[model samples]
Target: MKKNILYLSLAVIIGLLGGYLLFSINADSTNEDLTDNHNHLETTENQMWTCSMHPQIMQPEPGDCPICGMDLIPAETSAEGLAFNEIKMTENAMALANIQTTIVGSVEASDEDGIISLSGKIAENEENNAVQASYFDGRIEKLNVNYEGQKVNKGQLLATIYAPSLVAAQQELITAASLKESQPALYKAVRNKLKNWKLSDKQIDAIEASGSVRDNFPVYATVSGTVTEVIAKEGDYVKQGQPILSVSNLNSVWAEFDAYEKQISQFNKGQKIKVTTNAYPNKEFDAVISFIDPVLNNNTRTVTIRTTLNNKENLFKPGMFVTGKIEGAIHTTENSLSIPASAVLWTGERSLVYIKTNPNEAVFEMREVTLGVRNGDNFTITSGLKNGDEIVTRGTFTVDAAAQLQGKKSMMNKSGGKTMTGHEGHLGIQESNTENKPNSDLFMEMNLPVAFQIAFQAALEPYFKMVDAFVASDANQVLALAKTTLEKMKAIEESHLNKMENSHLSKSIEILDAISSNSDLKNQRDQLVVLNENIVALAMNIKTPSETLYVQKCPMANSNKGAIWLSTEKEIKNPYYGDDMLTCGSVIEEIN
Candidate 1:
């Protein structure tokens, strides 16, 4: 009975030990799970937050972006393995931006010639220009052509003149006609004298047949043409051989193009040129270089190139802008590689292009390219691009924008940094760095007459008034202000300005004149954008004594291309957006 009790005690002790070991294992597992949960919570708290619109902004805590006022989101933890100069974009974004690429290839031999592009205007052919002059000292009794651009036909009656001399001559002719048997030479002299006055032989014969003197003589058109100028008016006394009117024959016109010194070498007399005009975009007019001016215009540093066009249809009008392309075997070679100009982006002195590195994926890398001569719509790639390389032809600006947003190498930023925030990071918000500003040198060397300074500053007042009108969204007021500004600009003595300064002022006035003609606020604003550039250039060259000028920039203007205007005050008043965004600009520079 003692041996049976010992066996039961051993069994009970072994079962108790097994139960304790199982409980310890379960407690240790519960502690380990709790430790893992604490670690995951710590990691979630440490994730970096950043703004989506401004990817350059990063913070440890969630907040709004200081630059664009956008809420911050958690940054992606995975690193995007991209090169410093490379930018990756989704296919959908690329399509939405209208990005297009072209594969560079060898140009055909027939199309390898370099073309020279020139800007010019249609003008009257000097050879076809005619002047109508008075044949005798007389008073114009009646004028038929009232205004410029009136068309007159050959042998058409143009005017009536009352000439006492012609009446006396006619009386002498009658007397001579009676004495023709006795004084035939006198009679012939009288007739020849009337002929000298441009009287038709038929009219002279009719006068002699009636044996009566006519009070007034009729003037006829010698050539058929459009009257370009009316030199004389009715009741105005004119001397013999005095110009009465000027006419230009529209049967032929001259397409006069300006060629710079560098481009003049590519042109030769009789070279064939293809001309295009905005008025008739599809039609190409073929012409030959008739003449090239031997003298260069010092101010423009260009020479006029003339090409005659048969304008029998009168399709081309004077003052119409034209683009001429001269294709010749000038600077073209079989080994030359040319790309569309759209593929190139210009940032100061650097010319950059986006190179497609991957065919399957939408990957683009910024490349610095050396440019040669531009031929029509294409630019010759001197280096950095190969014949078989793929390049971004269209939407290059869009690509650069994306690169800028992603902190990749871009046109403005060669070595990309984290995206910038705040007012300094906004596009077109330029801070004045007086020490490094390009125009700083110009300011140091500038010297202007006191009169010029006062006049130029006064001119800005009208422009500012116009800006106020625009801010009010008053189209009529803008129009009226534009006219007043134009008159003020025109009244300025341009002779006081040097050649360069005068040229800038003239361009400004031309733009303002364009603004005056358009009552549409948008059109006026568009013109103002260009006018602002001219005024800024003018202000930079001339001294503004005792006056402070503010150079304001609007990034949202000109279809988002951005523009700058000169203002007298530090306050922002945007003319481009008018009342909708009257204060959508920042002061970029201050000129004193």
Candidate 2:
């Protein structure tokens, strides 16, 4: 009985010990799992998030951006050793954008092997133009040259006239001839008077030999050329020195070209130019620059350059389009680097280009450059660049856009900061994308024609309708209204607008075209701001507005840079932010 009791006690102890050992193993496993979970929670809490467009918005946890309502992204630190204005781009991004870099190299002046292209039209050489006029007042008895383009020669019989004055003078000559021995001085004076009337010696001798006065006289052409205009018709009386025919000698013609004001220094008289015409594509004619207008045309910002081309074959006709290629001799900039115009971007008063700072990486930075005269498709950089420097010559705008989105110094944003993001579309709002837009001031005193103002005002009517659609956040309505606006803009007559005003209207129409076809509310609204800039300038310059149009401004719109829009009513209805901030603008001017 004692042995059985001890064995039962040992078995009970072994059961208790085994149970304790199992409980301890389970407790250790549970503690390890709890610690691992805590570490994972701490790691998640430590990661901060930020909005890509609004880098200023930072949060410990991922969520929608408070300012733009965009999805939060993990904030990335700027590349090490990068300047405040410089931004690094991945090789994949550069390849996708097709960004190409060109190393600055010196090029010989366009005069030496390079051709400076010029466009112009052929015109009649004014120096060779002449007016065949009547030397004496007489009625046109018969007209030999009937129509324009009739070829005539010098001293050819142009017309026959019955001149009462010349007949009376002829009779005096006849009478004076008879009494030559008694009145030799009178006879000599009468002959000299006939000579003064442009009478040839042979005709005078015949009159003397006939001993009779002829009533009708023959009129001859003074110059040989094609008749451009028949000034006097048959049976019409003309006064002395009155044009009977407008003649132009087509042996030579003028090739007139307009040189831009900026390129005035590149041209001068006596420079050789190679001329070609579309009609004669295989032929090339050589000519020398005969004249260059000293005064600049304020309207076109160009000066007239003329060259004389021999047209003996009658190849060049007046008003025919011609192209002139002059060897650039004056601006022989030896060390200056010529860059493609595509490499440059202009915003407001600043001119910019992107420089690839790192040779091995796709890092880039914005550079402000002073441009010299443009030769063909390239321009000389007077400042802000040097030889061996690498620049983005192609896909420059793409690089600028990347810089803008990455909050680096860009053509649009001189000082780097967050720009508008796509998230604005989520709330049916899209702020203006204008970068340093020009002032919307009235130039009413410009005195554009009243007809033009009326037509332009009609164009603005549909723009106001578009604004209403934008305020309602109806993308379809915006598209329809934009199309209507584009039609109105197309109908605007550009004959009355000056060069600058025409440029404004053209850009406005281009933007309208984009807005019309776009279905995205954000992009359309963003384009709308750019369109309004041109539209407002045109509205203010309206010399005679039929009705009052309000010019309203929202200083907080367009990422706090401010924007303007035209409205028929003085009440503010913000299109950038619909009901969110309906009246967030104020009228700055009443355009009329």
Candidate 3:
């Protein structure tokens, strides 16, 4: 009975072992079949592969993109031969980047020479401006030109005045006329006095012949002009040399411009300006710069630049608003290539542009460029491009996206951020002039985030602390701390770094390496700048700090908000120097 029981157990064990082997084989076969099916489906599907980060790279096989070495994604082919790496963006990314696109026509430059924009205003010509004054004390009996902006011709009667002085002068002229044969010298003196009172020769002769005292006398205009002022009206009294009316010539007009401090260097006397008026669009008048005010007008904070225009048709009246372009020929450097201003992407220090090659092909590579003076809409391409090299005048941002997809070095990722191994010296990474200067201990730092701080502190704290010691003028501590810090920061974390491949932390590590290797700093003076910059970057990832003011959400102390200054912190001002909250301020003020 014992033998039978043992045999049964052995048999059951053998059967169980055989069943397990069979199940394992079947599972292995199923897995192989699934893998094969996946490969077959990938091959069967008509999917074009391209790099997500470097769109310029494309391959038929399922492999990494050559340029960036990132895994390939499907490319969206279009009829125009443009394969849009269509990104299905979340609502958040759209709002953050302010991404908007419109179907626009190809931008073309106008053939007309560049328009010179000048800020100016209407002014009366000095030669045409006149003030009408009475030669003798008189009372105005009638006014023909009674109000401002009234037009009058030369020698036109403007008013009639009844003056006692004029009546006495006329009587004296009459007496002189009667005694001319007996007292010729006295008669001549009396006639001259009447003439001095603005009595014309004909009027004087008539007054002498009539022998009656005329109380009212007509005042005639000395010159043709528009009436700018009327000092005396009908039945008003006027004193000698008192202004009766003021007039200005309307045949010509002056357009005065306020030249800003920067534009003054471009202007010169006699420069021709093409003037136009919204009142008359068809007509364009040529004007010459007649005067440039020697002193800047303190009220407007600008210098007056005057130009005269011919107004024969009287179209340009005084106080008529006008605008015009002044065309001035400027010399440029020989052999300098000019590109559309839209081509250059300005990123603070490094300005970049994309050169379009392979016009017929679906692909165009990005080439970094340097720029020179901007002449109107066209910029002079100093280096990194040749003439006739088709550049992306429009849709550059789109092309840059393709570059990033290709896993190539780009402006944002290459200059200020981490780059691939071979792209070391391609970026301008030396300490900024502000950082290089030996300055005070108090440094204005950029606010960064906590995560960035931690990562950076791990690699840079030692070097930074040593630099701080050096700043305190402790030479021995500086030397000791600097040595340890540099070593620890430089210690390669290849294994750990590999785990964080393609992460922001990985890129930040590259930035750290470059900064540590950079020998531009005389000492560790620029560590504060780096720390502040790092802090600001980290701050971007987290929610910005906020405070409550009257139940409304407001930015926290030392934060930026548009126009509204509300703070819970004391002693901290906004970037625009607005008032701080009671809660905002320095916890500990540093001694300078």
Candidate 4:
């Protein structure tokens, strides 16, 4: 019995030991599984990301950005405190947003200048012009100047006239001369009277020596000039003081121009003007403004600007059509930043621009800029901006739309102003593909193909978002999203009635871009709202213009009834209409 108990105890101990061994193995496997799972999580947390332009993308996990791609940079978020409206992105996001920037140096303060371009016709200077008239009633016996453009010297004989009174006067002089020695005083008085009648001393001497009555006398030129107008032909009777010819001095002529009321501010007495005439296309005449009309033409709404030009060669003639530019002082208000007028987006009240922020980021920020003056092609920024602030010299509209889609500020906000929400990620909205955009049919009732309509609809998707954002005054968001959508639509393959497809969409995209800049959107809000309404209405009304196709009206584009459609034969410069402009609405047309 003792032996049996010992064997049983040993067996129990072995069984328990075996169970313990099995349990240890299971624990090790469980630990290994847990460790593997933790390793996997760590790997996921350590994924890296980066931007296309900036390859310095690094991240602890798999996400959009490291530095500027998706606003994922911890430094960016920490640099500017996080806010609800603030959106941080990764480098990829930035690339997607097409956020572009450039480095800028400090700009020196300079005066603002404006240049006004105008067209005018060359005119004769009245002050330098003169007329030749008859001293007494007579008939022209001969003509010294047979045609126009004949030069005559001062006091030179121009024509001869015969009159009964003149004959009687000559007879009296002759009779007095016959008794010269008997009545010397009377003869001298008669001679003096002849002199008073404009008879030259030499002529009087010749008549006294001849001792005879002259039936006709020669008339002389009052001034030297070219005969511009001939009032009397040979043998034509003329009354006393009647004009025979109008003469204008060719040595010096008038460079006269008309300045409109709006351009009056540009007209100054002594402003240097470079004048050109059709007669001499290759030659240029220099002159300074000598006279400015105080009164405007009641019918033409223009003020006359006059200057004297040296036409000694007689190259310039009266009534010659001419064009000139009066380079004058640039008008400006005090304390302002002047940039190329092309840089400003005139939305109405405020001006907006896409300011270059960083070249590395290829990013620009939409800024509202207060304007003071417009000189020539430059504009003065009164407020909301500073010198050395780099702006998009070109393609600003495209950049602004990208900013809006990423929840950034844009110029087209319905609200008046915006506060910086901090650095957000780039959303690299699709670039505007204007290549295939066709002209709009806003005023036409023509039908388009189904495929074309579909393409158009696709293009409009982003526009709707853009308009919505604009109406809500979500400047940044609207710009960013709208830009992307428009860009994408522009890129899509389109159906076209003509070579261009969805051209009106491109115009709408441009409008959205202007809004995105946020410079002058407050003033332009009313106009923009009207544009938005029209776009929406048009989109809603998009249908087949004819039985076989679909169509929609782009109010900002297309021709209307009784309006000559010259687009087919010539280039159309109409600013109010086109494919890209379709979404701009009827405001352009209405105001125009």
lDDT, candidates in the order shown: 0.74, 0.75, 0.53, 0.55
Q: With candidate 4 superimposed using the best TM-score fit, by how many Å does residue 417's alpha carbon deviate from the native? A: 34
Say which candidate scores most in TM-score. 1
Give candidate 1 regions above 4 Å deviation: 1-121, 147-149, 171-191, 205-213, 231-237, 257-265, 273-287, 295-304, 313-331, 345-370, 383-392, 396-592
lDDT of 4: 0.55
Q: Looking at model 4, report the run of 10 residues with the lowest lDDT sum.
A: 560-569
- CA RMSD, predictions in order: 12.8, 15.2, 19.9, 16.5
* Model 2 TM-score on a 0 to 1 scale: 0.49
Listed in order, each prediction's TM-score against the native is 0.55, 0.49, 0.43, 0.40
Check candidate 1 and list the clashing pairs. Answer: 56-419, 67-422
Q: Between prediction 2 and prediction 3, which has the larger TM-score?
A: 2
Residue 154's lDDT in candidate 2: 94
Clash statistics: count for each candidate:
2, 2, 26, 74
* lDDT top scorer: 2
Query: Candidate 2's residue-wise lDDT over 437-532, tens digit each?
Result: 335222323456777778778887888889999887666688888889899889888887765566567768867776776554555665666677
